[model samples]
Target: MTELTPREIVRELDRYIIGQDDAKRAVAVALRNRYRRAQLPEDIREEVTPKNILMIGPTGVGKTEIARRLAKLVDAPFIKVEATKFTEVGYVGRDVESIVRDLVEAAIRLVKEQHGRQVRGRARAQAEDRLVELLSGATKKRKSANPIDILLGNRPKEPELSPEDRDKLVVQQDDVRTRLRAGQMEHEIVEIEVEEVRPMSEIPGMDVNMNDMLSGIIPKKTKLRKVEVREARKILEAEEEDNLIDMDQVYTEAIDRAEQHGIVFLDEIDKVAGRGGGSGPDVSREGVQRDILPIVEGSTVNTKYGPVKTDHMLFIAAGAFHVAKVTDLIPELQGRFPVRVDLKPLSVEDYKRILTQPENALIRQYELLLGVDGVSLDFTDAALSAIAECAWQDNETGENIGARRLHTLLEQILMDIAFNAGGGDAPEVTVTVDKEYVEKMLGADLHRKDVRKYIL
Candidate 1:
């Protein structure tokens, strides 16, 4: 994150998303500001709050993608929730506070994963020791049917056994250790006792923290089961890893990370933009916005882990306000998101670039998919232009779905080729898609006025 400047962040985003430079730049600067804040003195740093951004754009124009990619770039905890999925307090739907709780959960998971990598070596060594003990015990039980032979008696057994026999038992145990390390006994079945943790109940409207506490207090049940050595190693490794890490430290760092660098993307915010009638769903719309205002402006949310502070967390809201404008939102909520970025509607040229320019371009993706079946796909320059043009026309004629139209257009064009790629009657080993081939598949439909209804 410290190595990534604003320009570098934008460059990375360009690899997956085409166009939307204004939105890209806004997020890049916002992310760089986070780094800048961290460098400041503690007293002054606490005063600096993230200038939350509100991205106004149509759907499929990279609104959500920009926020998502920015989170990945900085390795920040990110959660995306639609505004419509939440309702005001007293309603049966999810409350807005769940967003913060969810973000904390993501942070805990991320931090735990990092800690796991750090302790993996020690965990593996410990697991190997346990596996060897299990295997050794199994070997001893097979050799002697007497339970007393396997169990330690008050008297020493060394005096009863001949020195030669004792030496042979030592060599046998050493050989078992050697084979265990070599993975030669991975398929050998072993009986082991495992503690089973009861799953938490999923009762709607229940406080998540209470459920967590209840589950923690419940005693775990243990049972014996036979599993292959390889499978047992994995389960024991996870258990050992958990025992090696300090959960108190993990929780502290997770909370700190969530407060300082977390990102919550509130999508479809337009759904909550009321028409100001203050009746029916409109009342709840305005109410939900009011509830979200405090969190965006800075507040504390209680989670099962602990209370998470939202003061410095970045909130990037997005809405395709085709029916309602930004002003329809409550004034307080709008004021919290000061940085507003409007993503331009995609054009035919943008569509062409999206098909071939991005690192994960649709054309490259299709080529790789077919290549796995010993079939190669080649798209001529003119063919790409025609496909882009078709997508642009469909968007213009129908719902104006922005860049998403390409997925439908390309899928329709290659449906037959994809279905028959590995079949008996597949195309040639090398298949080229030219302008003529595209036209033969879609030209008639492209000319029809009712194509939008069917193509979409």
Candidate 2:
């Protein structure tokens, strides 16, 4: 994050999201500010907060994509929530605080994965050793773990073997270990005990997780199942990694990471923009905004892990603002989002660039999807122009869905070819989508769109 200057950030963003330069520059500064704030004095750092951004644009534009990509670039704990999903207090709807809870959950998973990777090599070796014991049927003896077994003297009674027999058993186990390590016993079946998923009782409308509450108090139960050696090794390896990890450290670091570096993307915020005192469906719009205001303004949210501070966390709100303008939202919520950027409607050339540019371009995606079926997909430059023109014309005539119109157009054009590929052992085929083919397939739809201009 420190190395990513505002200029470099925009350059990186260009790889996936095209255009929206204003939006890109706004987010770049916002992201860079987070790092800048960290360098301040302890007393000064507490006073500085993230300049939350509000992105206004039409549907299918790059609003959410920008926030999502920004979060990924920094590897922050990110979660996107719909503003319409929550309601005002007294309404039976989700609370806005759940946003922080969910963010913390993502943080926990992220930290666990990082720690798991660090310990994976050691865990793999240990799991393989256990697998060899299971496969050889010359397993080592272990003490009983259950208190009932200790109390009733119900432990397994073992027959004492002579030293010569034990020596012979060791030799046999050595041969089995060598084969197991050599990947020669991957298909062999083994029986292992896997932990069962814990079920917990919970009451409705509660924020607390009942399962998490009882996790420490209840002892986990395991059941034996037969699985191939390859699959068993994975299960055992995961358990071994769990044993190696310090979960308490994970919990502590995760909470800190989420509190300091979390990103909450509030999408469809325009849906909740309304002046107060309205009745019926729009009554709760301002109410919802009022509720979201506190979180963005910095508040403490309780999670299963611990309390998380929203002061340092970044909040990026986006909406199409087609029906309700940004001014329609309550002033308090509006003030919380200090930075605002408007994403321009995609042009025909922008659509063409979107279809071809970016690391994960639309045309490249379709090509890759079909490539798995041994179908080589290619699109002529003229075909791309035709598709982009169709998308632009459709947006002008009907819904202004920005770059998303390309997906609909391309899917319709390639529907038959995708359906027919890889059904059986057929020779590889090459499909080049040309302008004539696009016109032939979408002629009817394009004609209908043309007719829409005549409607009013």
Candidate 3:
């Protein structure tokens, strides 16, 4: 983060996303500001807060994509939640505070994964030793005593092994270890003891802390099971990894990461922006917005792991605003999001770039998919232009879904080729998609007056 400037962040985003320059620039600056805040003195840093962003645009127009790509670029903990999924505090639906909890959970998983990688070598070595012991039958056997002797509080002891037998056992164990390291005993079956944890009872939409407490009180049970060496190695490796990790440190770092680098993308926020009228769903809409205000502004949320502070966490909210404008939101809630960016509707040229320009372009994806069946797909420039024009015409005539229309258009254009690629009646080994082929595949849909009735 300290190494990447705002310009570099935007440059990185441009590879996958086609347009929405304003949105990209706004997010880049916000991310860079986080780095800047970290360098400030403690007092000044504590005073600074994130200038949350609000993106106003139609659906499928790169609003969500910009936020998602930005989070991935920085490797931050991210969660996308629809505003409609939450309701007022007294309502039966999920509360807005759950958003912070979800973000913290993501942070814990991210931090734990990093720790796991750091300890993988040690964990593997320990697991290999355990596996060798299991294969060599070094585990102590329990003796079965008579019932009368057990009742009298007396038990027989096992005799010590002779030196010669002990030396032979050591040699056999060393041979097994050598074979195990060379991957020669992976298929050998062995019996191992595994601990089983009881499942805790859960109530719908209940706080997670109570479940944790209930689970902690239950004693773990162990059982022996026979498994192949390869499968057992995986199980033991995971167990060793868990044993090596310190939960206290994981929780502390996870909380710090959530406070500093977490990003919560609130989508469909316009759905919660209401007219603030009398009783009904509209009333709850405004209530939901009010509920989200403090979290975005800065507040502490209690999660199962620990209490997480949202002081410096970045919040990027997006909404189409087709039915309600941004002004409809409560004043206090709207004030939290100071930066605003309106993404432009995608154009035909944008569609063309989406199909051919990006690193994971739709055309390249299809080519790779078809190539798996020994079919070669080639698309001409004229064919790309025709396809983009058709997608543009469809969006203009019906629902404007932006670049997503290409998925439908391309799938329809190559349906027969994909279904029969490995069949007896497949097309030529090398298939070329030309302008005429595009017209033949999609011309009828483009020319139809009732575009909604024409399925792709």
TM-scores across all candidates? Answer: 0.86, 0.92, 0.88
Clash count for each candidate, listed in order shown: 0, 0, 0
lDDT of 3 by residue, 1-456 (tens): 545998999999899999999999999999999999889999899999999999998888888888888888877889999999998898898999999988988988989999999999999999998988788876555476665676576877756879998898799889999999999999999888788755677555665755577555544456788999999999999999999999889999988988999999999999888754435557778789889988998999877777889998999999989888888888898899999999898888989889998888999999999987879999999999889888888888888888889999999999988888886565548889999998888868767554455777
Give the backbone clash total of model 2. 0
Model 3: residue 232 alpha-carbon error in angstroms = 2.4
Q: What CA root-mean-square deviation does each model show from the true structure?
A: 5.2, 2.8, 4.6
Question: What are the per-residue Cα lDDT tens digits for candidate 2 across 234-275?
Answer: 999999999999999999999998988899999999888874
Please identify which of the two predictions, 2 or 3, would achieve the higher TM-score against the true structure: 2
Which ranges of candidate 2 are over 4 A from the true structure?
Answer: 140-162, 200-207, 275-282, 450-456
Q: 356 in model 2: Cα distance from truth in Å?
A: 1.7
Native-referenced Cα lDDT, model 3: 0.87
Q: In candidate 2, residue 328 scores what lDDT? A: 83
Q: Cα miss at 201, model 1 (Å)?
A: 1.4
Q: Give every collision pair in model 3.
A: none
Global Cα lDDT for candidate 2 = 0.86
What is candidate 1's lDDT per residue for 1-456, written digit by digit as tens?
456899999999999999999999999999999999989999999999999999998889999888998888777899999999998899889988889888988988989999999999999998887887687752232322243533433323323558887687667768888998887998999887687766667655544645566545544456678999999999999989999999999999999999999999999998899874444557878899998998999998877677889999999999999888899998888899899999998888999999999988999999999887778999999999998888878777777888888888888889888887896565559889999988888866576454557765
Model 2: pairs clashing at backbone N, Cα or C within 3 Å = none
Number of the top lDDT candidate: 3
